[model samples]
Target: MDAELLQRFNPEEFYRHFLADGLRPDGRQLRQSRAAELRKGALGSACGSASLRLGRSSVLAGVRAELATEEALGRVEVSVELPALAGALFREKHRALGLMSFLSNTLTELLNSPAVFDPAQLAVQKEVCWMLNVHILCLNYDGNAFDLCLLAAIAALEDTRLPALMAESGEVPRLAVAAPGSELVAEARQLALLARPLPTTFAQMPGGQWVLDPCAAEESLGASVSLCLVEGRWLVFHQGGGADAGRFLEELMPLARGEMSKLTRLLEN
Candidate 1:
């Protein structure tokens, strides 16, 4: 194709035609997501951390175990931040901030729920519980920020360990501080979550093709489908743009299940 002809070519229309036949311009099937990568224990200062990537996009998550001021156990605080560098690479600071806010609120709600993780596990007994601070930073943004953030956070939780805690009855049975990673500490490591709460997102292209794990380009022109699998059931089916989306779950379920399988293998390895 010459430059003049290529200049007039229509990529969107091409995508539509290709999608009609159950294919994408990138040669992936309709239900396939981009290859995903997970790196656990990336932050040395954090109690536990993990980095995750889907194609060019990446996120890093960390867990910090802090002494609780209140008597409540299993209380979690989550924060999502996009540094100036990340904003410059992606979009304007204000726009980036808005995007982060949306993702952050959704993640906060999900993680706060018992279906995602049991907060009760953070407690030692009835006396007190550890306050878990979960932070997620955007290293890169391709398309699925929610999915990547959740995965990274979960991986970070898996990697997290606490210093041996001691309680002595002086003023009010205050927590004792033992050195981190000390053999004298009785409970340093917490077990990972047994339920693998893998979430995946899909998007519908202009041609009404439901594409799983859309990249930056596809995401620009598609409606989104985000969901998490909970004990063999789907929770939080957030689909946007069209009313017909209700029936789309028939296709989305298999794709979400496949993503769950992929994430499970990543964690296991």
Candidate 2:
């Protein structure tokens, strides 16, 4: 039988054959991760934006700032869109909605956490402030969407610039976006992030082997775990299948830390 026919009919068998030889169909070792590419300020209209590609998975994130009342001050709202064209799984409406909700809520919580971003920075005064609306769109889905989304969000937020606040006595303050060549352009300030969080994702193959940065085919075959590191603390998310969670952490912590370090360096540069 040809390779394509075997893969189409018996993906498990095909994957097992490759694993037996200590390789993946993509020619990567079990412990290897895909290369990531990132670009900031990809959107001209938004306050900030970033485009990130992790292996074949691509995501774009944009941030827009709006004036808000005291009650909504310093709030960040996140929304994720996963269209059918991105992947076969998303072709089902329910599955796409479920995953979209999960990713949106998870990212909103992470971005709003004080350990990552300080809400106080958004405060313009006592009753006026800025609210950030962040939107993430997945252009391709090859697996590891969570990691790609989070990193894209961080990059967009870092690229964001808040306009100058204009206040008048006994009146609500407004934001001022300086025109080109205006001196007030210098007054606009970049958003300050308190911590840099990065995620390393691993897929647990059926045979009890964990593969780092699994592609779409490998992901469909097993459970997955994502470990995010922020300021010396870890946030873990696991889905489907069961294993010795503690043991998994023990074995993967070093690799995860190393991956986070590399990502941190990327952001810094």
Candidate 3:
């Protein structure tokens, strides 16, 4: 949906639709999604990857596995970028850089937090280890971009399989990843395992109506929150738009759980 359509939608009408059908204007059954598709190994050179299209919004996530530096070992470096060509509005170079910085900081915090991946498992040789460079490209915008990116990253990482690490010399401690036969498999072996903690997002529209995965129109109507759930708990990251956010959070709990269940099924299949 277009952002302009969202800006023009009447709050009263939107709420009326929700009340009538127990769903949103898009008729997604409150917890239902419009349809999502994921592509793995989309980028030929990347070690691991996936791309997801949630209706009109597109997210491409790539995993670059590398030996961790002393400071970054046992941690994941997740970054996001919306290049100028990716969106018509983001034509300026500075705008794209600024967005990348913002996204990197936000995701870095999540990856480092205890609620997400377990950083301790990344250790290799007691110092040098493995790190995940998760890069997200937002090729299109239609609201719910943050949630889609997070979901895509998790799914891509889940599908990723790192090869076993072997020492080349006892003195030098040189290591080799992946298996001997395939270069592709050998590259994958050098990395450590990745741990993923799931997160699901919900949006609260106007008139106290809550919806899971609100499209562009519903997102712009009022204040909304992105609730990041991990292991049956909530780790809220952002809630914007001068809305009565607390009440909305309480109301959307059940809806978020239901949507997450469906999402898990989609990825598993």
Highest lDDT model number:
2
What is the total number of backbone clashes in candidate 3? 7
| Residue 19 of model 1, lDDT score | 77
lDDT of 1 by residue, 125-194 (tens): 6656788888999876777777888888888888888767665558675666665554442376664675
What are the models' TM-scores? 0.84, 0.92, 0.76
Looking at model 2, report the run of 10 residues with the lowest lDDT sum: 166-175
| Residue 152 CA displacement from its true place in model 1, Å | 0.8
Please list all clashing residue pairs in model 3, or write none if there are none.
163-189, 177-186, 177-189, 177-190, 178-185, 178-186, 178-189
Misplaced by over 4 Å in model 1 are 1-11, 17-22, 87-90, 125-127, 167-173, 180-186, 237-239
What digit string (tens of lDDT, one per residue) describes model 2 on residues 1-269?
Answer: 89999999888888999999889999999999889899999999999999999889999999999877756458788999999989988999999999999999999999899899999888776676788999999999999988999999999999999876443335653446555555441256789889987888999876788899989899888889888888888898889988787766688777898787679877766
Where in model 3 is the C-alpha error above 4 Å?
1-31, 69-72, 92-102, 163-173, 176-196
lDDT for model 2, please. Answer: 0.86
List RMSD in Å for every model shown.
3.4, 2.5, 4.8
Residue ranges of candidate 2 with Cα displaced over 4 Å = 167-186
Q: Clashing residue pairs, candidate 1?
A: 166-176
Alpha-carbon shift of residue 106 in model 2 (angstroms): 0.6
